[model samples]
Target: MAAVAVNSPPGHADPPPEGRKRPPGRRRIIPWAVLALWIAVLAAAVPLAGQLEDAQRDESVSYLPDSADSTRVVRLQEALPGGEATELLIVFSRDGGLTDADRRAAAERVAAIAGAHDPAGGAPRGVPSEDGGTELYPLTLTGLDEEEQAAAVEDVRALAAEGLPEGLTAQVGGPGALQYDQEEVFGSVDATLMLATVAVVAILLILTYRSPVLWLLPLLSVGVATVCAQAVVYALVQAFDLTVTTMAASVMTVLIFGAGTDYALLLVARYREELRRHPHPLDAMLRALRGCGPALLASSGTVAAGLICLLAADDNSASGLGPVGAVGILCSLLVMTTLLPALLVMCGRRVFWPLIPAHGSEPRAGRGWFGRMGASVSRRPVAILAGGVVLLGALSLGALALPGQLKSEDSFRDTPESVQAMERLTDAFPERNAQPILVMARDAAVPEVVAAAESTAGVADAEPARSGGGWTEIAVHATDPPESEGEEAAIEALRDRLAAVPGADAAVGGPTAQQMDLGETSRNDRMLVIPLVLGVVLLILIALLRGALAPAILLAAVVASWGAALGLAGLVFGPVLGLEGLDPSVPLLTFVFGVALGVDYGIFLMHRMREEALGGLPTRQAALTALRTTGGVIASAGLVLAATFTVLMTLPVVTLTEIGFVVAVGVLLDTFLVRTYIVTAASWLLGRRVWWPGPLSRRPEPAETSPAPAAGDGR
Candidate 1:
C-alpha cells in the first residue's frame, strides 16, 4: 500500500488538490531511469575492474623518486644488455663450523643451480668467511621479467635445498629474493583487504541499523562504487601512465567503503526523519537529499582535495595515491548520492521493517547519550575543553620515542626466508658487504671510475661487471655489512669520489642506496605535501561551513588528533606490537587520511548545527540539538571507518600495519573524543563567534523560553 502523510501539517497529505500534485508519470520514471543507468554502468565497470591488478606497478623503480641517483642508476641499467639483473645470494652454513663435507655439498648445490639457471657469471664462486662457519655464493639472474624472476628465485631456492648435508642449511637471499617475497605478499593483499573490509563494514552497518536488510543496500552500493572506481583507475593507468601500487589500491578500497558508508548513513538518517513528514518514499528521499546533499558534497570534496595535494610529493607511491584516493572518494560520492537513494525509495519502509518508520511516529524519547554529554559540556565548556586538550597533549608526547627510518629487511611483520637469510649473512660476514653497490659510468671513463671506487674509504673491491649502451656497470663491495652505518657511509664516499672523476657521468645505486633515497624523499614529501593538504582542507571547510573560526578550529583539532594518533602508534607499535620502525610513507599517509577523514564527522555535526542556528534555535540549544540529532549516526560512521582500516593490521606488511593502526586510532579519537567532546564544547563556549565573519555570527540570539523539547531532541 502507498504511504499517506498521517499527522502531517496542513496541505501535506497525499492525493493533494489536482493543481498542486506533481506529474506522477515523471516522478515514477526518474527512479527507474537512475536504477537502469547504474545497472548499465556496472555491467561495463565490473569487467574492467578485474583488470586493475594487471596495471599495478610495485617494482623498486616504481616507488622510487625519479630525481634520486638510485632511481637514475636503475633506469640506466634497464637499457643495458639483458636489462637489470635479479641479484641473489645463497648462504650455506653450520653453527659450530663448516666441515669440508659442508663446503663440498654447498659447491655441488651451487654448480647444480648454475647448470639449471645459467647464472650471469657462468658459475657462482663461493666466498668463505674467515670464521670458517659460513660460505656465501652470489648469483645474478638477468633477462627475466618480474614474474619470471620470481619463478627463478623459487626454482633456485628449491635446487639449493636439495641434497644438503645433515646439520647444514642453505638460504637464498639478496635483493631478488626479497623482491620475490615482498611481491608474493602484495599479490595476496588485495583479496585479503577486500574480504576483511567488506566483513567489517557489513557488521558495523548491521549493528548501526539493527536490521538485517537495511545494511545490505549501503553495503552493495559501496561495493558497486568500489568496482566503478577500480575501472576508472585502471583506465587512468593505461591512458595517463599512472602508477598504482598494491599500497595505493589497498588504501583506495578502505577509503571508498569508509567514506561512502558515512555518506549513506547521513542520507539515510535524514530520509528516515523525512519519512514521518512526507507521504511518498520518493518525496521523502528528495527532501532528505536536499537537506544533506551540500554537506556530503563538501565533505567528500575536502577528502578528495586533501588527497589530491599528495601530487606535490616527490615519492611516486605518495603521488600515485593522490589521484587514486581522489577517484575512490568521488566515485563513492556519485554512487551513494544517486544509487543509494533510488534503492532506498524502492525498498520503502520494509527495508527497515524491525523498526519501520511510520508516517508520523516520533523517534525514541529521553535525552540520548549524546544529548546528556552535550548538556554537560554546555554547563562547563571551559573545563571539558581543557581536559580534552590535556589528554591529546599527553598522548602526543609519545612521538618523541618513535623509532628511526625502517630498513628494507625490517619492513615485514613476519620474518620471511629472505629476511632470515639477510640476518644470517650479516652475522656471518660482519666485515664484508654481501650486496654490491652498482655504479654506472660512461664506457670510456670506466677505468677511472673503477680506480675511484676502489680507492674510496671503506672499499673492499671494485670490478667492472658488464658494458652496454655506452655505459659500463661496476660492482663495488664495501668492507662493512649491508645496511650498516659503515656501509651507508662507504656508499656516500663512493658517490663523492665518483662525482670527482672528470667526464665519468657516474651514479650510485643498490639496495642500500635505494633505502637511503627512500628515506630522504619521504621526509621531503612530508614537508611539501603536509602544508598543501592542510591548506586544501581548510579552504574546503571554509567553503562548506561559511565560517573561518569554525573551519580553523576543526583543522586544528584534526591536526592535533593526527599528532596524538601518531604518538599513540609509537607507544603501541614498539612495546606492545614488537615493531621496530615505521614505513617512511606511513606518517604522511596517515596525516593526509586522518585530517581529511576526521573532518567528515565534524562536518556532519557542524552542518546540522548551522542549519539549526539558521532556523532560529538559540545558539547554545542549537549546539546541543545538532549533537542530539547527529551523534549516533556520526558514531556509527566512525566505527565503520575505523574498523575497515583496522583490517589492515592483519596483513604481514609493516607499512600497511602501521597505517591501519594510526588511521583507525585517529578516527576513533575524532569520533568519541574530538568531535563529541572537544568540537561541541568549543562551539558551546565560542557561541556566535564560532561563525565569525559569517552573517550567523552577526545575527542576534533568539529569546529563550521554557518550551517543551522538540521531536528530534531525543527527549
Candidate 2:
C-alpha cells in the first residue's frame, strides 16, 4: 500500500486522521460569520458603553454600608426639603494675616457668589478665622443635581479668583466642593484608564509575541470585550439598579483587559504549538481550542466565582464590584475563546511571521531554563519549600506597619484645590470644626436632639440648620480635628447620645461620620468577604482539579502571596510613596484580585502537570514537563497582567494607585517565585499525593528509565 503522508510536527503526536478535513468553503464562511457577528455586537454595544459614565454613582450612599448610620442619614437627606443640600466653604487665606483689603475682597466675592447662585437658606456671610489670617464663607446651594452643583461651585471659584487681593489665595472646599472635585477626577478616569491600559497591553503583547500582527488581534479582541462588558453593566444598572461606582467602572476595565489578555495568551500559545502539528490553520485552531478550552473556562470561572463572593459584603461599592468584575471576566472569556480563535485562523500561519510554527518543524531540543530549575527543585524539594515559606513569611511581617484608614484629604495623589483648602482650614482653625457633623431627627424631637448634641462631650456647638418633611437638620461642630481619633470618638458619642433621644430616631452623617462608617464597614466586610472568597475559590479549584489536596495547596500559596503583597505594600506606601496611610478597601480588594489571579497561574501549571501525570509519568517527571512546557506562557501572562495594572499607577487617585501597585507586585511574585519554585517543589515532594483522593494518585509511578526527551526533542 502507498504510504499516507502525515503532516504532524516533529515532537507532537500525529493529528487524528478522522475528522481532520473540512470543506474549504465552510472554513472560509465560519470565520467571516464570526467576524461579522462580533462587529454587529460591537456596534450595538457602543452607545450603551458610552452611557456607563452616566450610570456611575460615586455618592456616599453608593459606597457606604446600608447598616451605617451615615447611610441612613444620606437617604433621609434626599427626602428633605429641596433635596440634599450642597454645602460650600469659600476659603480665603493669606500667610501674613488678612488685611482690611483682603477681608473686603473676600466679602465682595462672597456677596457676588450669593447674587449669582441664590443661596438656599440665607445670603453668604464671612466667618473670620481666630488668627485673622483666613476667612470662610459658609454657603448652602440647594435644589441642584450634581451637574448644577459643580457648575455653582465653579462659578463661586471664578468669582473668588476675580479681583483677588495680592498674596491672598482662595478656594472652594466642603463636602460639596470635594464631591465636585472627585467627580471631575472620575469624569476623566474612563478615557485615561483605557488609554493607559491599551498602551500597556499593546506594548506587552508586542514584546511577548514579537509579531506586530499577532499583538493587534488580542488587543482588538480585548477592546470588544471591554465594550461588551460595559454595555452589560449599563443594562444591569438601568434595569436592576446595580450600583456602579467610578472606582468599579475603572476596575472593570482593568479586569477585562488584564484577564482577557491572559486568556488570549494561553490560547495563542496553544494555537502556535498546534500550528506545527496540523497542516491547516483551521484544524490547528480547532485542536488548540480543544486542548486548552477547559483550562481557560475553569480559569475564568474561578475568577468569576471568587469575585461574585463580594456580593456578601456590606459595602455597596464592594458588592457592586462583584457583578461588574465578573461580567468583565466572562465577557473577556467569551470573546477570547470564540472570537480570538476565529481571527487567528482567518489570519493563517503567516501571522506568526519570523517565528512561524511550520508543520513538521520541531521545537529546539534541550533542557530549558524551567527544566533546569525543576531539576534543581526536585533534588531538594524540602529546602526549596522551606525557603519559599520563610521568604513569604518575612515579607508578610511588613503588614504590621500598614498605616490606618486613609482619610479623604489623602485620597488623591496630587493635592486638589479642595484638599488644599481643607488643609488651610485645618491649620488656621484648630479649635473649630471646618466640616460640621449633620444630625437628622424627627421634627417633633428636634429640640431634644439639639439639646443632647449641645450637651454631648467633644461637641463644640450644636445649632438647628433646617426643618421640614417631618425631619430637622442640626449641624454639630467637633472640638477635634477632622477624621482624628478625638473626632471619631465624638461622632460615636453623638450617635450614642442621639440614639437615646426618645422617639427621635436620629442619625449622624457628614464627612467625619462617613469616614468612620467606611472604616468600620470595611473591617466588617473583610471579616465576612474573605472567608466567602476563600471558600468560593477553594470550591472551584477542587472541582477543576477533582481533588482536595492540590486545591488546598493552591489556595494556601495564593493566600500567602496576598499577605506578602499587602505587607510589602504597607512597607512601601507610607515611607516610599509618601502616602498618609493605606486605604481601608485596599486589603480586601488586593486579596480578591491576588488570590483569584494567583490561583489562575496555579491552575495552568497544575492542569498541565495533571495531564502529564495521566499520561503515565511519575509526579516528579510530570512536574518538570509541566514547568518546561507552561512556564514561559505563565510568565508572559503574569507580566501582561501586572503591566496592565501598573497602568493604574498613572491615575491620580490614591486608591487606584495602591491597588495597581499591590496587585502588580502580587502577580509578579506568584509568577516568578511561588508558581515557579514553590508549587513545583511541593508537587515533587508530595508526588502522586498532590492528586490525593483521586484515582490517579494511586497509580504506580512509571518504571524508571532514561528521562523523557526534553520538551522540544522529537523523540
Candidate 3:
C-alpha cells in the first residue's frame, strides 16, 4: 500500500493550480447579492431624503433658568413654527425717530396683514420690535404641516408685499426665511462641489491611470455606494424617526467617493503590479491579492475605526455620522476587495486592455527605484525623522490660527424650499437670527413676568398676550440677532434688567444661546471622542501587529497628525477662508475624521512591516521590504483618499470646504511623510525596539541588485 498523505490532494504535493489562481467560493458570490440588496434600498431612499424636516431648530431654545412665564414663552416659540405661529420682521424707515402717528400706522398695518390669513382666516400673529421702528409678527399657519412651512412663508411674503403703509416697508424673516437661506447655500455649494468634484476626480484619475476605461470603475462603485448609503440613511430616519440635516447628501457624496476612489486605487495599483509579474492574468490576480489584501484590510479597518468613533460625539450628531460613515466606508471597501476583484476577472485584459505589456521571466520583490528608495530611507533613519518633523512643523503652524466659529446656516443648505426661503429672508433682511428669545414664567407668575420682561433692557415695549392666563405674554426685540456675540452686550444688559425683577428669574433663551451651548458641547465632545477613537485604534493596531509598542507609536503619530492638521486648517480658514472664526465645530470634526482616519496609513505600513519581520527579515530589511512592496499601494490609496477629501474645498459651505482641505492635506502628508519617512525611519532606527516587548525582531539580508525593472509601470 502506498503511504499517501491524507491532506494532500490525491497524492499530489499541492492543491490544484486553479485553486491557487481563482478566488475562493464564498468571497465571489456574496458581494453582488449584497450590492443588489443595496440597489433595492436606494430605490426606496431618494424620495425619503427629500421629505424630512431640516435638522436645525426652527424651534425656541428652552432654558430652565428663571421665570414661570419662561415656560409659557418657550411653549409659544416651539409651537409657533409648527403652524401654531410664525414671525415676520417688520421694518419702517422714517425721516426721524418713530412718533405716535407712525407707530400707530405701522402697528395697524402689521395687525391688518396678520389678521389676513388664508380662507380659513385664523389671523396671522403680530408682535412689535424692541424699537417702535420695526415689528415682528408671529403667525401660526392654522393647519399647515412641516412640509407646508415653505409655502406658508411665501404666502405671508406676498401678503406683506401688498399691504405696506405709506413711507413704511415690511419684510418677513424668521424660521421661514432661514429655511430659504439654508437651501440657497446648500444648493449653490452642492452644484459647485458637484462640478468641481467630477472635474477633479476625472482629471486626477486620468493622470493616475491615463485610461478612460480604468477611470469609470471607481465612478460606478462610488455611484452604487452613494445610492445605497442614502437609502439606508433614509430608512433609518423613517424607521427610527432620526433627525438628519439636509447636508447628509453632500456629506454622503464626499465620503462615498473619497473612500471609494481610495479603495479603487489600492485595487488597481495591485492589479497593475500583478500583471507585470505573471504570464497569465488570473495568476497575476492571485499574486496581487496575496501581496495586497492584508494591507488593504489594515488600511480600511483603521478608517472604519476612525469613522465609528463618531459614535463618541455627545449628541446624535457623532453617533449619526458614525453609522452613516462607517457603513458607507465598509460598503466601499467591500466593493474594493470583492466586487472589484470579480469585475476585474470579468473584464480580464480590458481593464487595462490598451496598454498590456509582455510578462517578465519572473516576479520579484522591490520593483526597482521605488524599492531602492525604501531601502535607502531605512538606512538613514534620523535624517528621515528630522525631515518629517520639519515638514510637520511648517504645516502645523497654520493650524494655530484656525477660526472656531460654526456658521448656523450650514445645516439648511440642501433643500430647494429651504434655500428659497432663506434667500428671501437674507435679501429682504440679512440680519435676522430667525429664532426669537423668550422670557417665560410659571402659570401663576405670568402677569408679573410679562410686566417685568417688558421692562427689560432689550425690550422696546411688549404685547399683552391674547391667550394663556397667568400667561400674560410679552415680546422682547433684539437690537441685533440674539445669537451674535455682538448682541452679548445687550443680552448682559438685559440680564441686569431681569436681575432686578421681583420674584422672577430671566435667562437668555434663543438661537444665540443654542449656538453658545452647541459650541461648548462640540468642544466637550472633542475632548471625549479623540481619546475614545484613539484608544480603539490603538487596540486595533495592537491586535493587527500583536505588538505593544507599534500601537503606542502609531497613536502618537496620529495625535501629531491631528494637531498638525488643525494647525494647518487654522491658517487656511482663520485667514484665507475669511471665516469669522474656525467653525468651533471644525476641530472636533477634524480630529475624529482626518486624524483618526489618517491612522490607516500607519497601520497599513506597520502591518506589512510586522509580516516581513515575522518572515525573518532584520528590522531595516523588513522596513525596506515593507516600503518597497507597500509604498506604491499606500501612496496610490492615499492619493485617491486625499483627492476625494480635497474635493470638499469646492463646496460652497465653509465647513465642508475647510474640512476638505485640511483632511486632504493630512492624508497627503501621512502617505508621503508619515508612512514613507517617519515609520520607516523609526522602524530602522529603533531596530528591534519598534516592535518591543512582544518578540525580538531580526535584521535580515539586504540584496543590492541591479536596476533593470519589471513589466507594467505607473507611479
Query: Top TM-score: which candidate number?
Result: 2
At residue 176, give the lDDT of candidate 1: 91
CA lDDT, every model vs. true structure: 0.87, 0.86, 0.59
Tens digits of per-residue lDDT, candidate 2, 1-715, equal 0000112321346546575468899989888899999999989999999998899998768879889999888888888877888988899999979999998888888888888888876677788988999998888887898778888888888998899977998988999989888888878888999998999999998888888688999999999999999999999999999999999999999999999999998888877777777788888787777777878888999899889989998888999999999999999999998899899989999898867778877666777777778888978999999999999999999999888888989999888899899999999889988899999999989889989998988999998887788998889999888899899999999988989999999999999899889888899999999999999888888887879999999999999998898889889999999889777788898899999888999998888888777766777887877887788778889999999889888898999999999999999999999999999999988889999888878888887455665753221
Error of 3 at 350 (Å): 2.7
Across 1-715, the per-residue lDDT of candidate 3 in tens digits comes to: 0110012121112223664544556445554565565567557756654443343222322112112233334555444323234443444434334566665665665556566654223443433434444444455444454456557666666666564556665555554455445454654655566566666677777776766687776777666666566666667766775545434456556777776777677667656655654655556555566655765676667777877777666544445666667667776777666556656655666677555434543233325555766756756778878888777777778765665566454442233333333333333333443345545444555566556656655554444333343333334555454455655554556656666666654444444554554566676777888788778877877777777787787777766776777777777664565565555556767776676678777766776677666655566666666666666656766787777788776655666776777788777777777777777777778777887666553343445334334222333
Clashes of each: 0, 0, 42
Candidate 1 error regions (>4 Å): 1-19, 23-27, 706-715
**Consecutive 10-residue window with the lowest summed lDDT within model 2:** 1-10
Among all windows of 10 consecutive residues in model 3, the one with the lowest summed lDDT is 1-10
RMSD of 3: 7.3
lDDT of 1 by residue, 1-715 (tens): 0111112221132333355655778778878899999999999999889999988988898889878999999998899888988999999999999999999999999999999888887888899988998999999888999889989999999999998988999999999999999898899999989999999898888877888799999999999999999999999998999999999999999999999998888888878877876677888788777767888888899999999999899889999999999999999999998999999988888898797888876666666677778878988999999999999999999988887778888888888899899899888887778889999999999999999898899989999998899998899999898877898999889989999999999999999999889888999998899999889888888888788999999999998899999999889998999888778889999999999999988888888788777766777777877787788778878888999899999988999999999999999999999999999999988888899989899999997654344334211
Q: Estimate each model's TM-score.
A: 0.96, 0.97, 0.78
Q: Output the number of the lDDT-best candidate.
A: 1
Arranged by TM-score, best first: 2, 1, 3
